[model samples]
Target: MTVIVRDLRPDVPADTEGFARVRRLALPYILFTSDSVRHNAVHVPAEARYRPLVAEEDGEVIGTAQVHLAHDSAEPGQGLVNIYVRPDRTGRGAGGLLLRAAEEHLTAEGATRLFTWVLDEPAHRAFAERHGYRSSRSSHFLRLDLAGAALPALPETPAGVELRTAADFADDPRPLFELDTETMRDEPGDIDVEYTDYDAWIEQYWKHPLLDRDLTVAACVDGRPVAFSVAYTDGGGRYSTAMTGTARAHRGRGLAKLAKTHSLHRARAAGLTEAFTGNDAGNDPMIAINKWLGYEICATEVRHVRELG
Candidate 1:
């Protein structure tokens, strides 16, 4: 069978479904949906030059790659590509073809360096290394069984604090954006990103298809959000915490943990069964909080960087 790598056609429903299906199968711990796939394809900023490539074999999409520049990062010429092939179709040359296309595209777009996240497995690491990528930081994919897991009770709000939902900010979400921007400064990552575009943030985050407004909990200090746990549900039984962070000023007050706890309780009550979240391996605080909430390490992946000659 001949495998051909080509750009994913977002207007085609089957292409989106196939991409999501392969991603779900290759990385079960993380959540993927057809809507998310389409959203990224359509809403990606022009500066990022984001492209989703699919490897088609025998009329089936067996592999996928998301290639893009780090547009939001202060540093330029930093590109990234994540490739995933169906578990059963690994040896059919699909991955290599997808990687080649992604690399060519990114290099043409002026990428001096590229990065990718590869699953922490023998074959996966081997593939990355063979492609000249060197290992860097690692992260863990965590899972919590919301159906049966016993989560911590939400602590009483401080005298000046209150618990609210992201839905409460329907009139305006600038506060949440400011809080997220501040919290992200402390988030462990290889890239340094500053979220300065409110319109871009709204399109990419606040209006995302998977964001569950009702289940997303926020800790407010006198009507200003200080901490929050952004929840995403796939309209099935799967719920994921997209982000849980506390503003620097609110650190050590356990507001993040409290917000996440409330979000989890509400998610389970709404019939979501599985909860998923990922953390940088070095983020002890978030890992500890997740562990406190009964989450376990389900899988791990390592970031790999390669210099383009």
Candidate 2:
């Protein structure tokens, strides 16, 4: 059994399915489909130099890796390599092979800092540590039983507040972009991003295959978006809240929760069974909101960083 790591062939049907299978098995918290996988491999921004890799043992894929530079980050030379192997195939050396390939590619691309997410488990942490990666921040994957969880009732629109969907702004989504720009800046993360390229945002996010425009709820105050819950559905049973945020001024009004609750209810009505969301471990406010929505911390992953010479 020899393991070989190579670039993902989106055009090949089996490679797409194999890559999606490994990701789903290794990280069930996120939603993935063959289409989404293929789209991501092909539609990545040129500046990002995104490369999706798969570790194939003989003819079967056992692990996957997404390697890319943080092009949008305010700081350059930050590379990301998220590797996941099938739970059943852990001891087969596939992980080391994938990591080696990813690191070589990223270092060649001028990466000075490399970051990866390792599941917050003993074995995973040990593997990262052995690879010279040091733990930095952590994050949690939260799950909610959309069918069984009783979501909070939708709140009444305040005197000036209104609820709308992302699709409602199809004619003009700059407002949502502006809202995202403001809200995303507040999200806790390793890299600081400045969303100045509206066109890039549109191509990278607005036009993604999984973005459910109708289910993405937004809160408005006098026609301006103040809070929003971005939804992504796999067109199957699972739905994930890609992001839920409130503007700096709208922090305490509970509008972010309101938007999320409304989005979850809408998702449930649309026949989605399970919902998933993720938050930085230190982001207590968002975690509390997810708990209010009956989301339990299903899994946790810690950010591991290494300096790339």
Per-candidate TM equals 0.99, 0.97
**Lowest summed lDDT window (length 10), candidate 1:** 149-158
57-79 per-residue lDDT for model 1 (tens digits) = 99899999999999999999999
lDDT tens per residue, model 2, 143-230: 9999888888877766778999999999999999998998878789998876888988887788889999999999999888899999
Number of the predicted model whose lDDT against the real structure is largest: 1
Kindly report which residue pairs in candidate 1 clash with one another: none
Runs in model 1 with CA error above 4 Å? none
Tell me the lDDT of model 2 at 213.
98
CA RMSD of each candidate after superposition: 0.8, 1.1
Cα-based lDDT at residue 134, candidate 2: 99
lDDT of 2: 0.92
RMSD of 1: 0.8
